[model samples]
Every structure is written in C-alpha cells, then in structure tokens.
Target: MSAGTAAAGPHALEELLGDPFDPTNPAGYRAAVDADDAGSVADTATRALDRWGAGAEFVPASLGGRFTAVDELARRFRPAFRRDAGLGLGYGLTSLMAALPVWAAGTGAQRDRLAALLAAGRPVPVAFHELGHGNDLSANALSARPTADGWMLDGTKQVINNAERADAVLVLARTRADDGPERAHTLLLVEDLDDLPARGFARLPRYRTTGLAGCRLAGLRFTGCPVPRSATVGTVGHGVPTALAAFQVSRCVTAAASTSLLEAALDAVLRFAGGRELYGRTVADLPHAQSLLAGAYADLHLAQATATTAARALHLHPAGGARIAAAAKYLVPLLVEDALNDLAVVLGARGYLREGEYAIVGKHLRDAAGVSIGHAGGTSCALTVLGQLPGLRPAADPPDPDLFSGRPLPELDLSRLRLTGPRADPLLAVLTDPTGTGSAAGGAAPRTRELLGGLAAAARTIGIRAAALPAARRGVEADHRALALADEYARLVAAASCLGRYAAGRVDGSPGGLPPGWLDAVLRRVVRRRGRHGEPGSATSDSALLAHAAARTTAGLSLDLDPDRVVRHRPHPPRRPHPSRVLTPTAGGTP
Candidate 1:
C-alpha cells in the first residue's frame, strides 16, 4: 500500500479517524463503513471508541479533553473518517457539535460539568435544527416556559445525530415568544434519556441518508420536557450568538473532516490509476489521469491548509472567528466533491460498481454531500457573513464587474514599516532624501531598506505565481481551478504577512508616497484579471480569496504598515446562468 493509504499506521489515518482514537485499527473502522449490515456499523463504531480515545477532541485539556489544538485533531481525524464516513461523522463530527454548546456559551461551571460528563463517556448530542425552520436558531419553534421550580421544553428537533444514544442533549428552546432578539432563547442540558417526559421526546427511525449512515440522525420531539433553571447553558435570550459561536468551531471541524474525505478520494484515485489498464497501458500513464491526480492532490493540500488556518484562528479569536471558519466550511466540501468525481472518472467502470472496496467511494460521496448542507447552514449563509466584511458589496447589474471589483488593493507605507520595534524606522530612512533628510542624509542605516527590499521581492514572487496561468486550456478543470484559487489566496495571505512584518518594525518603512490612484489601478487590474474565463466556480470562490487577503492585510496593518491601497467591494449574490437565458436554442431543441 502507498504511504498515504488509509491502512497506514494510526497517526497516518488520524486525520481521517480523529481522537487519536486508534493507531492500528483503522481498517476495522473501514469495515464499518463498508458493512451491508447497519447494526454492525453502529456496533463497530461503539467499539471503535476504545481505540479513538475519550473526551471531546476540541475541548481544552483543563476541561479533561485530549485535543490541545483544532489542527492536530483535524489531521488525525481526516484519514480515518475518509475510510469510514459513517463512523467518523457519527463519533467524530457529532461529538464536536455536541460539545460546542458548553464550550462556546456555557458558564464556567457548566463547562466543567459538561466536560466531566463527556470524559465519563456520556455522549452529549446537540438538538438545534428542526423541520421547516432551516438552521436559524432565532426561527426555532421549540418553546421553553418557566415554571415556579424550573422550565418545560416543548418542541422537536429533526436530524439529530446520536439522539437515540445520547446521555444528555444541549437543547435550544425559545424562552420568549416575541420575534425580537432578547433573552428569548436558551440552551438546556437535558439528562436522563429514559425519564424524558412521557411522549415529550420520540426518536424517529433513522432516515435513509446517502452518507454518514452510522449516525442515528433521528427526529426528536419534546413535549413539555422539563428542564431545571440551572440547566440553562448561558444567559437566557442569548442562544443565537451562543449557537453561532458554537458553529464557528463546528465549521472548522467539519472543514477538517471534508479535507480528510478529499485526501481519501485522492489516494484511491492514485492507486486505481496505477493498477487499472486501458488502451494497452496503465491508466496512470494516461495524461488525463495524471492531471486529475495532480489536481486532486493540490486541492487536498489547499483544503488541509485552509482548515488548519481557520482552526488556529478559532483558538486565537473565538468571538469573530466565523468568517474564517465559514471560508473553509464553504470551500472544502466542494473540493472533496470535485476530487471524488474526478476519481470516479479515473476509475472508469470499476468506479461505478458497488461490489468492491470502491463502494466506499459512493458512500463517502453521499456523506460529503451533507457537509455543505448540514447544521451550520449552506454556502449562501456563509456568503451572507462574508458580505458583512468591510468592502464586499453585492453585484448590482448583469455582467457585474462590481461583483469582482470595488475593493482597493492593499497598500503598505514602507516608511512606516518596522523591522523589530513597534515604530517605523527603516521605511522612514529609505523615504528620507539622502541629500536633504535627517536620517537618510546622515547615513544612519541601510540594513532596513535591504531587508524590506528582499521581503518585497519575495512577496512579488508569490504575486507572480498568483497571476500566472498555464497556456494549455485542457489542464484547467474544476479541481485545478479550485487549486489555483486557493494558491492565489495563499499569495494574498503571504503579501499580508509581509505587510504585517513591516508594520511590526521587522523592517523599517517610512517610504515616500506613490502616485495618486496607483493602488486603485493595481486593484482594478487584479480583479479584472482574476478568473476572466467565467468558469463555474466553487461557492466560496470570491469570498474565500478576499477573506484570506483581508485577514493578512489586517494583520500587517496592525504592525503600523499600510498597503499602497485597500479596495473595498460590495457583496454580490452568487451568480447562476441558465442556458435559455444565455443563448437561443436550435429548432431541434438542442442547445
């Protein structure tokens, strides 16, 4: 088997399996995903826990959790989950979501209590989504009323994973009837699964889902389910923000899981290409197969990197981490989808069969389908959040350039750039006229300029890569396009990093001013040049690149540096074009 194969050592599959759950038993988990028997899959997952380890993966060590960083957990879980989608989704993702209510909004006491409960092997399921309500917590029809002693929860939550097996459920309920935002909603920790009020909670039969079938995502109904006043996770009426904060973590984890699936798909395609012969040669020798494999690998890397960055951001800035998390959430699932489809093409007829190991591919494809549509809401929701960022405006007209333009290119004041201290020194020296200025004329120092120049040159190299495209049109498939977009995003982030270095006084910058509108000119050029072909793009195409760039620039600006210019664009709704709308059809009815 290849080194990247799912059966590799425990750590190799950790990214797919998550939880350091096990190092040697991944194949067993793989069996769970492949088993024709549903009960067997659930049984396998329940027993697999011994190897996966205990406690919520994202919870802090102080809270009796094993995971210290979200990235570490992501890497470990990616492989295992890829091998067995159902096991991963059921135990890995559902656990992450179940733990979020307490981590994001629970009181200190609540956090300790919930953490302990999880450590003791009691799975906590989150019941937030309901039928017909979409994923909006504010639109929740579930009601919680206060009694003399406590509160009674009356409502139903649909598509709850592990609901039938949960020891406790972090239930979201509307505490107030009004539509206005207030202390109207609350999250209650409901324990005692058996004692759940008579007919208050019912577990509907598992829906025949396309993927992640091991999870018992049954509909749950709560009719006058009593909850204690102390059972509230956070303040009453703050469930919306609390739930959203929890979603940030969920988005990050889900992105990681999707990345795992992509990696698995890529690995499968690589092996299949090598062994499967066609036209008197192995498929691996074919140019198309090679290109597909390469493109898929690149996308896998992009997904992993993006998820890692978002996970780190979650640790640093929990409050405003939504946009970054959403970027990964929106991007990774699409990447996995493209990767799987490409793999199917490479596998040809064998890919279509469900008789062998390849059956997992279809299972994974189904499981991944839900990643974009699950609890955190769809890509549309993610775009709405991106629209709120500074300089993103919706498109106003047909063939709208405003969808891609309006944001100024980031500018940095070289003179204000700092090499080490918080103040600008090297930049000031360079900008100062050597013949007539204070520092420059005095020949105070030249090292800062040299360093700044070197860094700028490196940044330009990245920018060049971002701007370049292969001349061969055949190579630019959907996966390739996705990879290229991610690459550009990385370059933008690198530029932001360079800017931040200068701002931090890592390099001196008090550089002279540029010609008026120079920054605007550059921005316009970049936006116009980006994806000029109008190829169908991922849901996060524009926003992901912009968000990454914005983040880098924001960090750089913190160092007191300035970009030549900053372009802010209005947010535009995602574009969709139909055939009839674009061109006339032939009389034969063929377009």
Candidate 2:
C-alpha cells in the first residue's frame, strides 16, 4: 500500500471527526477557541468527544476502547487538531499523555481504574515535565514515601496541562530517597484536585502560553498529599522505562499535531494568496511567493511522510519505538517551524495583522515554537535517541537469515527514499576532492561504476555481520557515537543513490533516470547478509559500504545537480466548500 493510504483494519478516530474545511459552515469547527474563551474550547471538545462516542478513542480495544488499531486512532484524532489547533491538541495530545502511564505501566487494576475514569468523561493530564529537568526520567524530584496504608507524595510538578480540570493526574515520583537516579521512582495517581490544598497539594494559576491555550497548564505542589498503596501504577523502580515508552508514543502524536497545524496554516495562506492582489497581480502570481509556497508544500509533505513512517515503525516494533519516535520528534518540529515561517513570508505584511480572522496564524507559529523545546526539546530528543540506540544493537550472536529477510531495512523504505537534496552537494564535494583522488572515490574517472561496486561490497559485508547478531539488537544505538556514525552512513548512502542514479542515467542516455530497482535490491541483500554474519559484521560491513560509496562518488566527475534548486514547487489552489449546512453531514467529509 502507498504511504498515505489508510492502514487496513478499523477506521481511525480522526475519520470520525468528519470534514473540518467545509466553507459554508465557516464556524463549522467551533470558533470558541478563537474567541479566547477557554471554557468554551473545553466544553465544545468534550461535547464533540461525547457526541462521537469517542470514549475509546485513545484506548486500545484490548482495554475496551473503540480503537483496536493505532492507525484508526491516529486518523480519528487528526480532525480535532485540524479543526481548532488548541482544542485538537488539548483533546488528542494531553489526553493521550494522561492515559499513557496506565497503558504502559499500569497494573491490571490500575488500568481498569484509569479506563473507568476516562469512560466517565473525566480527562486526565500527565505531569511528567518539571522546570529544569527535561525528558530525563531519571531526574524527577517528586518523592513518594511509603506508609502503612499508602504513601505521602511531596514535590512540585510544573507546567502540567489540564491541571485545573482533569479528573486525575499521573504523577511520576521518586519512591526511594537515594540519589541513584530518578529511575528509582514510581508513577502515582493523584485524584482529588478540589481537595489538593487540604491534602498539601496546591494548583498554581495557568501559565500564559502562546499556543494550546485551553490546556490550563499550571503548577501543582504536593506538600504532603497522600495516596493508597494501590496508587502505584506499575512495578516500583521501573517507572523510567515505562515513561520512556510512553514518550515514544506521545512524540508520534505530537508530530502528527505539528503536521495538522502546518496543513491548516498552509490552507489558509493559499486561500488568501489566491485573491489578494499585489503589484497589479495576485500575490500567488509572484515568483518569490511561488517559491515560498513550493518549499512549504514540499516540507509539509516530507514531514507527513516521515512522521507517518515513524508511526508505522512504532506500531510494528513497540520495543524500539523510542528511538524511532525520537527521530520523528526531532525532525518533524523543525520541518513545521520552517514551513510556518515560510507561510508568513508568503503572506508578507498581511500575515502579521492579528486583529483579523487569521490571527491564529501567529498563534500557531508561537505554539509550534514549543514543540522543539520544553520537555520535547531537541536535546531531549537527542538523548533519547542516543539512549535507545544502545538497546537496539544486535547481540553478539548470529541472527537467523530468515529474520533479516522478512525485516529488510525495517526503519526506512529504500525504494522511494532520496538523499536530502541539501546534503548531496557537500557529500559530493568530499567524495570528489582532488587532493584525496582515488582514496575517496575508490577508483578512476568512471566514478559511478566504482561507487556502485563499493556500495554492493559494503552491503554484502554489513549484511553478513548483521545476520550474525541477535535480531533484537539490530536497531539499538549501542552508543552516542554509534548513532552519529549510523546517521552519517545513512546520509552517505542517500547521496550515493542520488549520484549513482544521475551517473547511470547519463550512461544510459536517460540523464535523470535512477538505477532501475538497484537501490531496493542491493539494500535487501545487504540486510540479509548482515543478519547472517552476527553483531560484529554488522558494523564492519556498514563502515565498509560508507567508505566505498564515498570513494566512488567523490571522484572528479560532476553530476551537475543543484541542491539549491527546489524541485517540488507548486501553488495550492483555493478549496471551495460545498453548500451543505448540516454538521453531521459535514463531518462525513473529513478524511
């Protein structure tokens, strides 16, 4: 199936929200958010949730919710974000975070308890981020002390979303006093917000945020809040791994949210550009505006594809989900932020006007700023990626060949993958450096042939080594340095593919044609061989391929491809809404 095709199985939660772009019903998406009425956003979201019978929207069918498939949930939840940025984020993301601890580490009883609360229409918010410490699950300071009947929790959880209204808060706290690391902590359920002060827990006023306003992110201080022993969500001291896993899932959804936000902003900008005249022509007719539009469009598509790919990987391999999620979280935000800025450029001065209906553009741009910072910052993403890579390294034994065959390049699709156009030039420069000569290109004037041969050999060797390692360790980082190396290797491979395609095409009289099925076949064979060779061979073989590809492409042969030339430029035509008036019928138009 194509990448964007709906996954085979149940319909997604996003599919349930219906079409948000209906023009005739301009307020079809509840503008309560635009009115700056927090209560209205929350109330409208709750009504929509209940009306769609989306109680099981986030819960897996195994837990008794409507969604039996993650894809379905992702699809269903997408519309909410598309409709209203703040409400979509509050309903979809905040709720998911609130419910994740239960899904990851909750005991059967805990799961049942939390699931029941959600069913009762009480939204829960997750309290995982603290002031200074970000994504370091091991640095949490909230403490939970054991008592005869339960435990006393004391600490301050800052920047908690939905703190004022959530039925419960999943608080991560250190149970052991020792400074071994926050991993020695437990997840505790805090249930009475109204009585927080009496229990020594107080809620600070919500912080003024640029986006996701309806969230009510506030600080909660637990002076000495008490909880039953059963409040522990999972095995004590295992909270870090559980929380990390939950973070992986959350990152995927967050990326999806970013994508939705970009899409909405792009749609609005496109509509405005079409009719707004500048210099005796529509802004859309300007060359620079077209360039900006194209770049934003390409970036938005790339972000969607990358995020969706990461989501699919998470669904299939929930074990190594963290690393994949980290990659998506890091890359997608950067993509969306750039696109948002480009949209502003496309609009010029008109985009800056806040008193009008399009004020949300600025709001979204501000909201998008948080995605790459805070708990989900780039540093945190890098650390998580580093940490998770080690866990994906293959064990020191040979893995079954069949295993590698079935899981060839599990994390990336070789067929359609292209070297990032920007990186291609520098890599080519390195490969073709005159001083290095054959050392980099690995041969003489026929650089393409040499590069292809080197790529094949490296693939063969790595394939053998990978085959030897245990299947479970293949995707682990092993170390920070290893991740950097792997990233370089992936980049080099992409560059070689680009250059190789250009080279082969030149020889075949099809200057831009890529090698027919060469990339896919070679990658498949390499992975198969690595699976057979064991752990050591995997690294050795990968390094060999990198070295060879570098040498083959860097020789003095110029491929004449300009990385600066944006290839996928196109202006978005305005979307006109059907003359439908009913909300229920309009909902069905959403995909």
Candidate 3:
C-alpha cells in the first residue's frame, strides 16, 4: 500500500461520498454545483467529512490524531478536494496550516490544547499575509508590543481564511523593530476571539475572491488587542524561521492534495468524450481528441508524482524539503492548470458549464487557478527556489531509497524542518548521475537510460547557469534571466522525482505498475512543458497511454499512480435536502 492508504485510505472518503457523477447523491458533484451557484458549500458534503473523522487527519498521532505521515494526510484530504475545493480549503486545510507551526514550536500546553481543539472538529484560522504585504512576511505591519501582563497587538491582517468564525487565531506579528529583520517577528496563538473585540480587536469585513468563494476570507484589526505572553507559539523573535518551516510543510501537502483538481477535470473530459460525437465517431474515437485526453492523463500522473514526492521529502529529507516544496509550489499548480486546460480542449462547451454534468470541471478549474496565487504565489516560490539552486550541488550520498518505495516513514518531526536547504540536493544526485548504476535506480531499458542521460546533461547546464549569476542579481528584484534559470531547475527537480518513482517501480516490480510507456509519455510531457528549455529526444507517442486513460475511466479506475477503482456514473441515489451554507465553527470556544 502507498504510505497514505495505510491510514484509512482515500478510498474511504471516496466511498462515503459516493460517485460525484451521480447527479442525485447528496454529497456528490450535483450538490457541489448547487453550492457553488448559491455562493456556498453543501452542508451534506462537509458533514460527510466530519462523519468520516477527517479533522483527525490534521493533528499528529502523538497528539491523538491520525496524521502520522504527510503523504497520507495529503491523500486523506484528496477526496474532499475532489468533491469541492472550497470544502477542502475552508473546512480543513486552513486549520491545518494554522496548527502546523504550533505543533512545530508551541509549548506542551499549547500543543495539547491545539490538538484537543482540532480533535473536537473546531477550525483554527491563521493570520499572516497582509493585503499590502503578500509572501514577504518580513515586511508585515502587524505589531505586538510587550507589556507587563502580556502583549498588545495592533494593525490588521487581511484576506485571512476563517478569520471571523474561528475560535482561535494564529497571528504572525512584528515582535521587535530592529536591524536584524530575520528575528524581528513572532507568532502568537490568540484564543477566545469573542473577547478580543470587547478589548481592542475588530473583525474586518469579508473579501470576495474569484476562487474559493465559499471561504470566510476576512481579517482582524487590533487596536491594542490584549493577548497573554503565554500565547507565544515559539521562541520570541523567531517567527521568520517558524513560519518559513511551516510554509515548507504547507506548500508540500497543499500541492500534493490539490492534484485532485486535475483528476476531477480528467474525469469530466473523459465522460464528455465518451458520450459526445461530432462526425460519425464518438469524441473518444477521434485521434486528435484521444491524443489530448492521453496527454492530459500523463500530465495528471506527472503532477501527482511531483507533488507526492515533495510531500514525502518532508519525512525523508526535512532539511532539504524547503527547496523541493518551493519548487513544487512554483511549478505543480501551473502544470495542473495546464492539464485542466488540455482536458477542457476535449471538453469544449461543457467546460464552461457550472451546473450540469460537467459543472465540476469548470468549478475545479477556477478553484485550481487560486492554488498558484494563494498561500505562496509563484514569484515568492520561484525566488525561494532560485536563491537555493546554486547551492544544490549533488550530495555525496543518495537520498533515502524509501523516499520512492512507498513505505511507511517515521512521524514527521516538525523540529527537523529547516528554514534553508542543505549544502547539496540529494534527490538531484539521481537525475544528474547519468549512469544508471550510480543512482538509486534498478536496471532499466537502454532507451530509458538514454533519456536519463539527456536529462542529466541538461540539469548540469541549469546548475552551472544558476551558479554563474551574481549575488546582486539574485534577490527579490532578480532579473528575468535568473528567474528563468530557476524555473528550469524546478522542472528538472520534477523530472528527477518522476525518474525516482519509476526506479522504485522497477525494484518493487509490483502488481500496480502503471501503463506501458507511461514513463516515456510523462517525460516527454515534461520536456514539452519546458519547451525550448527541455532535453531533446524524450518525446514519444502517447497513444497507448490515452487508450489506458479511456479504459480506466470507463472501468471506474483512477488515472493516478495507485490503481484504485472509482465510482463512475451510476443511477443517482435518492436525494435529500442539501442546504448550502458557509462553514460555521464554534466560536469563543477553548481548546
């Protein structure tokens, strides 16, 4: 089993929610459509997640929760995202993002209290990004002044998810105004929001977003809001490192779980392609349509592979996880967005629908567009990666083989996460080692080795180019050429991850191996994705993969790494009232 399937399995969520294509299932796509139309999410679906005890997936097993592995946590959250991106983000992900830092550095009392709150299914929101300052958390204007009793907070944090309804809030504030910007901020976990307004806090108005519209995207204004000194989540003047580590973890899992959007889009396109006909043949039979569908499937696989590997790196290589997660957050969403658009090519008019059989496709597309810009925008992620690329010389040792073996890993130790990457990138060693014998890879066909040879050569060039750039040209005001090099480096990391997964399959020789030529097809897609910057001679026919996609879709099997049966079209189950409403967490509550 994949590490995640060991814990409750994504199939559990899939089964409980039933077939999304089944128009009448209360917790299915039809309900999702209605909710989106009404500017909210379906209570039935959110409640189904609650019934499944998904909240436990957010807290760690040490803290009496089910989230032992980051990979499993991502998978466990997949079904919710596949059902409704808003449901996944608003109901659970925000809370998890809010709690990770606390788990990483909070005192024993803080950890225990936060765990109890999450266990009881309450949402805990975070405030970090201000409207004026995006990912540059260092420039944040929120200030928490020290006083005898505790600290008094001022300024407003805008565009925060669940800001109004959450019982507690985690705020990243400027704790010290000093020359050392890195140590100027601190994280404060403020609880009991109900009393904050009575003191000096004001809940700000909601901000409407194009995507994730259902989220209560509001803010908090503190005109001397009083929070005890004990509210400090970690050491004083260490918010930068703490938030940086949390960002790595958050970027990894969010990118992994969000790949579900690609899957849902593929499902919609396949459904439309199978039933709709233009000339004399079904759209699925047309060569052009088949090619697009197959390419989209390969992209889906590629996106999932890259995302899952990055998440897995958290356990296997937390010290280097920052760079990989940064790369993923920078590239994977665009890949998914590209794949969605490719499927939309096959989907045509139905891709525009928001309330029909193919409504989920359009909705997922809009929601996915937010993934690239939300939390960490593309520029921030790319810069994070670019700054580290030059230092990514291949490590002397190979990364842990279990990184790709799908084996269970030790519980993710948040303390192990680093604000900076390692002296060398271990995962790159596999891709840069042209000789198959030198890598963690098992024996492969001569042709596969040739492809690796090309990739390795290109990767060396990227590294050299990145290393050549002057330090003056590598900051936030970095030139376009430097950033482009970073983009190329990120793609190579993704391509290397694919090779790692392929190598594991060879050693594993498992029953659930992917379709033949799946590796070649996906590699070429990456090359194609890279355009003029990619390695040569990797492109190959994707016909067989397309046939596999069609067969899998018709058979109700997922077009991902794992070959699990999915709920395809079925007679709609009996319908029940699905009231559309925003998420309502218990406020003014204690953990």
Candidate 4:
C-alpha cells in the first residue's frame, strides 16, 4: 500500500496554480484578494480548478473520480484550501457535501447522475438547513409533499451555495409532516431547474457575509415545484439517518481540510514576523512575539493530528467513530481560530491590511473564524458527542496501530457508517488504559507519563458524569454544563492522539522516534487548554517549539505531523534539511 496523503507526491494543483506569492500571477493571492474585494470568487481560480478537474475530488474513484477515503480527500483539497477558503468551499466542499449522501444512500442512477454533473464541472449544493432553523435541521420548514407522480417541493432553503447557477440542487424537505422529527424528512436531488417556471421555483438574491465574501451563499425557493419519484435520495423518511451517515465523512474531511485556512494565516504571520523590523530588530527577535508565534504553531500541529486521527477513525472503525469525528470537528476549528488571533497579534497592523502581501492574514482570520461554526458548528458537534457519551464502550481495544501509520487507508465504505453505532472509542483507551503501550506504560518520559495520568483521570471523571446524565439531558436538550463535558472530552481525545502518536513513534527511542521534547510541549498545551485556571507551560519549552516552527518555515515545509509533506501553493525548493531532524509521521503525515 502507498504511504499517506503525500504519497500522491506534490499535488498537481500546487504546481499548475503557480506561486501564490507571485504578484503578477492571475491566479495568485493578489487575484484572490482582489476578487474578495469585489465580493465574488476569482474567476481565474474557478476556471483553473475546473480545467484541472478539481470536481473529481468529490467523485468516488469507482465512478471515475479521485475520492477514496476521507483523509486522502482532505489532503488533496488542502492545496486549494490553503489558497482561498472561499474557493475551497464554493468549488470543492459544497459539492462534496451534496454528493456524499447520494454516495451513502442513493439509487445507482442517482450516483451516476451526480458523477456526470460533477464531471461536467458543475457544483451541486446541498440544502439541508433553512435560515430559520440554522443548525437545527430537524425544524426545517421546506416541504416536499408527495404527489401522484412524485413529490412537490415548497418553501425556501436559504443560505445554500451555488443555488443561483446550478442546473441541479440536492434538497432536504419534509415529506411526512405528521411523523416524528427523524422520520419526517427526505433527501431529493432536484434537477431540471429549467423545467419549472418563475412561480414554481426562484433563486433568491445572494446573501452578504462578513467572511468568505467571494462565496455565493444564495438560496432556492420552491413554490409547488414538481419532481419525479426518482428524485428521492435513499428512502422516504430515512433522510435524517442518511444525512447523518454522510455527515461522518463531511465532518471529518471538511474539518481536517479547514486547518489549511489557519496554515495560510500562520504562513503569512511567520513571513511577516521574521522580516518586519521593530525596535531595531526584526519582530522574530522579540521573545514575547516568539512565544505567540510558536504557541500558534504548536496549536496547528495538535489540530492537524487531532482532526487527522479522527479521519483515520472514520476508516478504521466507522461503527463507533462518529464521536471522534464530532470531537475533531468541534476542537480543530476553535484551535485554528485562537491560533489565528495570536498570529494577527504578531503581525500587528499589517495583518489587517487588505491590499498587500499580508492580506491573507486578515482574510484568512475571518474565513477561519467562519470555519468554527460551519457544518452544523462546534456546539452542534459537541452535542453529537454528548449524546454518545453514555454509550461509550470502555473495553474496546485501543485504536489500531495503523491509525497512525502513514500507509494508505481503506476506501471509505459508506455502508458501514451509521447515524449511531457501538460507541467503542479506542482513542479514549490511549488515555485510560494505563497498561496499554499508548499511555503511562508506553515508555513515556516521567513528565509525559504524569500528564497522561492527569488526563486519564479526567477522562474517567467524564465517563462517570456521562453515565449519570438523564437520557433527555444527553442529546440536543443538553444544558451548557453538559456541553462543557463534551468539550472537555474532546480535549482529552486530542491529548490521547498526541500521546498515542508519540508512543507509536517508538518505545525504544530509535532512529525514527519523534523529536525528543515534542510530546512534552504538546501535552503541556493540552493540559493548559483544559478547565479554568489551567496549567501553564514553561517559557523555555515554548521557545524551543517556536524554534521548530522557524526551522520548518526556513526550509519551506509544513509544521504539522507531516513536516516533509509540503503542499503550499508556493513551490519553494528544498533549502536545506530541517535542523530538528523530525521524521514525518512514521505513522502520520506522509509523502
């Protein structure tokens, strides 16, 4: 089997798109910024991606497209997300979201039609929520009443993407209003927009946004619009469950790729901090600035590892992996937003500029902030975990070692993914299982072991509280306090992933071991991010972590688990070997 994402080698988009830094390149950062100013996506980027068949990323490999697994899909799209978050969402993610449910539970003809539309370079937007319901999709007001021939759709699905121009739209509508919340809805791939007259269906005006200005966030209104019975996706009344299964993939893939938004922001700050002078020295010379930059860098790595491990879980254990997917989606975006805030500080006023080289820092800051709430948001995702907590199977074996391995993952089998399954979370075992090689007995150093023990204790405490929660309190009805438990549980999941990755590097500390002190710094970060009055990391260690950040940038590489795997639009040739001697994820980051 091939090694991880990088096994694809330098992505074609990275090479074909040209250096984003080149001021003259029409598809470069300047173009993206300029397009954002005009409140429209850069047409140059749209056409380039279409010409490159970027839509293929959404199609399944079996159907003549590149999609195979969630992680691989994330890695492929990183090159795009790192460029313009709007482009990534408008041209990439939205289509993937609309297509996934079809892949998971559509008639063979529906899947084939989706494959063809995407191949023709058209984005099919999924309309799951209305403006009134927001993340509470269960309350969606759109109605798809059953007709003699098929169904008649009515009401507005606001806040949808590409609604104004797409030839087709995938909509979720109430087919049985009298049924329970989960059974009232159905998914329909509505096509033949031209078949309906103005009164039957209309495209609403584009909604303005504070971030992702260039994205076309529009709406579709259907007033007694008719669609044949073939429009039904999956089974009638099973729409909610079908959507849930597909969400496991979208949550993992989109959450993982969204980190590149912060990567773009951090890249801008590092570039500015190392060069811009302040008080007779470059900003990089300031200790305080170094700490902020380094801490942000460390946060990025943890976010990457956590989201990625969740992606791996989708493949290795889809039955009980929804919690991990939810956890990663909840935490990574928050981590990226906080990191962007720190980076904006280091960049100072220049970070706010909209017309210069550092424009991306300001732009990405806004885009990354939007990421925190996208795809039903961190709060909704946390609820997803809270509902599953009481069912967590503690005796489940630790995550398969292959979860960390850089090798190729199995193809995504939507058939195995469900709305709810055995909540056997192996990542939890990494913290609670003291005898397992992933934790205290995994040859971890004294400080590392101590941190693991504390987190393990916290994990146990949450398990107890979860068991005590009334069934009513475990779901969407959960209060703020119960939601906080989900947040804490997610933090512990991230911690376990870090420790698991470090231990998997090697118990004997051989040639392929992770850098000597990396685990200490990250675990301390995890601990510090916990409950109020959190633990503080040492200044010296934070400085060392900053040095790693600096070294990687100096060599034009990523700062995450996969240090050697460079996917930036700027094709900076190797300057020199990294000074830290960090091996790419022997079981993580690849190429």
Models 1 onward score TM values of 0.64, 0.65, 0.91, 0.90
CA error at residue 55 for candidate 2, angstroms: 3.5
lDDT of 3 by residue, 436-456 (tens): 324422344566556677777
Model 1 spans with C-alpha error above 4 angstroms: 1-30, 36-42, 56-58, 317-320, 392-591
Tens-place lDDT digits, model 2, residues 496-575: 33333322332221222212222322323322223121111233233333233222223311111211111112334434
- Arrange candidates by TM-score, highest first: which order? 3, 4, 2, 1
TM-score of 3: 0.91
Q: What's the lDDT for candidate 3?
A: 0.78
TM-score of 1: 0.64
Cα lDDT tens digits for candidate 4, 60-108: 8788777887877887777677778888888978888899999988889
Q: Which rank order by lDDT, best down to worst?
A: 3, 4, 2, 1
Q: Score residue 480 of candidate 1 by CA lDDT.
A: 50
Candidate 4 residue pairs in clash (backbone atoms < 3 Å)? 404-587
Off by over 4 Å in 2: 1-33, 37-46, 192-199, 372-374, 387-591
Model 4, residue 201: C-alpha shift (Å): 1.0
Task: Indicate which candidate wins on lDDT.
Answer: 3
lDDT of each: 0.51, 0.53, 0.78, 0.76
Which digits, one per residue and each the tens of the lDDT, describe model 1 over residues 1-591?
111233333343333333211223434423554452363254544454434553445456556565555655665564446556666666656767767667656678778777766665566778888878776567788899999888887777888888777877888888888758545788887777777666676777766666566666787787876777878877788777667666766777777777666655554555455555444555665666665554454345445545655565455433334555665676556656766787677776666665564556666666788766767644443443323232221112111111112222222111221111211112122212232122221332343334334433433343234235342321223245434444333333222222222222322222211122122222222222333211122223222322333343343211001222211121232233343444343575312
- Report how far off residue 18 is in candidate 4 (Å): 2.0
**Count of clashes, each model:** 71, 50, 0, 1
